[model samples]
Target: MSPSLTFRPPTTDDAALLLAWRRLPEIAAQSFSDVPDDIDRQRAWIERSNARADYVHRIIQVDGVDVGYGSITVTHAEWRIGTIGVYMGDRRGRTGIGALNFAPMLNHCFHTLGLRKLVNQIFDSNPRVLKGQALLGYRHVGVLKDHALKDGTPRDVHLFEMRAADWAAVRHRFGLFRDMDANVTG
Candidate 1:
């Protein structure tokens, strides 16, 4: 069966699923916060993020099933700069679906939102994320050593970026933005 992926903004209805996904041990380990077991905290977080104009939280769906989340935050400045992050729920990992979800998200950020640059920071240990980012036209900008303390140990983070011009130039190499007209019509 051919599988299709899509993304939509998160809503109150997705709070439980998001909480569940976040609760997975592997997912929590890579995230900023340990997944909260309390529903109230999850609801509060959702409410706060939903109210913020600068934050966007989206649910990624594969074959109409919610499988992951993608977020982008616009940096405050005259220039159009933003940072993006993605997390696939435990069950969705290693399935090569993350990129499918990421494609439209990138398109939306650059084309629909008019952003000039998008940045991604991946933990040095997570080569899977690094590969996914590279597949999406992000170039390795640099590495921040001992940047984050995960599980009480310092970890480095590799910074990757794709400028609007860079994306336009190398997008075809990745086949992500290739056949744009066909993707839009289908």
Candidate 2:
């Protein structure tokens, strides 16, 4: 059986943890350029996000232990769309727990948050993430060539989106409800 996972709003005390994960090469490589690495900068970013109405940073816990982080950010106001980003810290990444955690997190974004669409940007070079997102029902939108510079090299990024209707159609295909109930009760 998979370890249980849960998410909660991040608190000020979590600033340090977030900073540590953000600095990890595995996590940082997948993110956009201009991501802050300094502890003070990360702390300030957390404070600012906490105060913003359109942003939420959440801590992902597995069996009561902090293992990673995820966030839902309003990306397009006119479309009522949001983007979700998640990373499984080193420990959990090796255990295949990241995908399990995303199930509930995605449901929360679509059902609880009432988001019309969820967008994810995956680096074209990161085929692992692209495959995972496809398995989760995200449709390929388009690629933004030379969209970001990571490690001082321009890289292409593929945009994927899961609309409300698409989610409703494909969610049950994974038996997500059973997993969701188990997660809630286990």
Candidate 3:
């Protein structure tokens, strides 16, 4: 059988798992946030995040094994805008499987959540993600020089945004099509 990607809400029980992924040297280097080492702190963060109405976090699994995480933080509710990011923790699952997570993520942000636009920020050091985002139809907005610090050195952050209309046009290439009645938001 072929592998499948799935997502579920993350709970405090996942603190250790998430912390381990965040602490991986490669993952830590690419992350804008500091690598968290404490389980209690991670648990607290999960708790706080789970309680927030504007934050959506998911633990990504491949055939039942947790391998990554994804999140969308609604930055401007009125404008239906949110910032999205994802990272894979399992090295075994990193062989192009991470890209599969993007479609569902985009579907959740644009289709399920009724978000009009989704913003993605990537560190200049991560060319792989930069290229993938471009190929997925995200338009480059601008670069924020010295936008973040990595290993004590300031780095640039490339901003990309995808409008619902833009995704509607290209999502089929990713095998994601629009569902006429799936986007109704109350």
Candidate 4:
């Protein structure tokens, strides 16, 4: 059986743990923001992010142990569109998990947050993540050619999107619901 997963709002107390994960060579390579080298800056950034109305950041825990992080930032409040990002900081938690870790975040964006659309961008080099995106029902929208410079070379970015209208099918395909589907139908 898969380990149970939970998520909670991240606080300044998490800054150190989050930063250590962010500093991991593999994790830092994929991040858009240059990982901060200082703990104080990380704490301050977490404080600022938590204060923002348009952003929701959470720490992902597996069986009560923090293992990852996820966030959704509303990019267009008028249109109810947002961008979502997630990474598993603890390698052990990532084993056999694939895209399943994103279930709660996806549901939150479409249902609780009432977001009309959610966007994601992945580097072309990361085929593993690209496959996971497909598993999660994200449709490839476009590619930004050489959009980001990584390790001194420009790299393409693939853009994917999930619409609220498509969430029902996705939720059903993945069996992410316990009793919510009945509520929706009834």
Report the lDDT tens digits of candidate 2 across residue range 95-185. Answer: 7574666677667666766678988889987787898888888999999999888888999999999987887777765445422223331
C-alpha lDDT (0 to 100) for residue 183 of candidate 3: 38
How do all models score by TM-score?
0.85, 0.86, 0.90, 0.91
lDDT of 3 by residue, 1-186 (tens): 667667788988999899999998888899888955789999999999999999988887888788898888999999999988788899646775656677777887888888999888899989989999988889999999998888789999999999999888877776634222223222
TM-score, structure 4 vs. true? 0.91
- Top candidate on TM-score is 4
**lDDT, candidate 4, residue 78?**
92
Ordered list by lDDT, greatest first = 3, 4, 2, 1
Give the best candidate by lDDT: 3
Off by over 4 Å in 2: 174-186
Give the worst 10-residue stretch by lDDT in candidate 3: 177-186
Stretches off by above 4 angstroms in model 3 are 177-186
**lDDT (0-100) at residue 55 of candidate 3?**
90
What is model 4's C-alpha RMSD? 3.0
Report the C-alpha displacement of residue 170, candidate 4, in angstroms. 1.5
Predict model 4's lDDT versus the native. Answer: 0.81
| Per-candidate total of colliding backbone pairs | 0, 0, 0, 0
lDDT of each: 0.74, 0.76, 0.83, 0.81
Give the CA lDDT, 0 to 100, for residue 35 in model 4: 81
Where is model 4 more than 4 Å wrong at Cα?
178-186
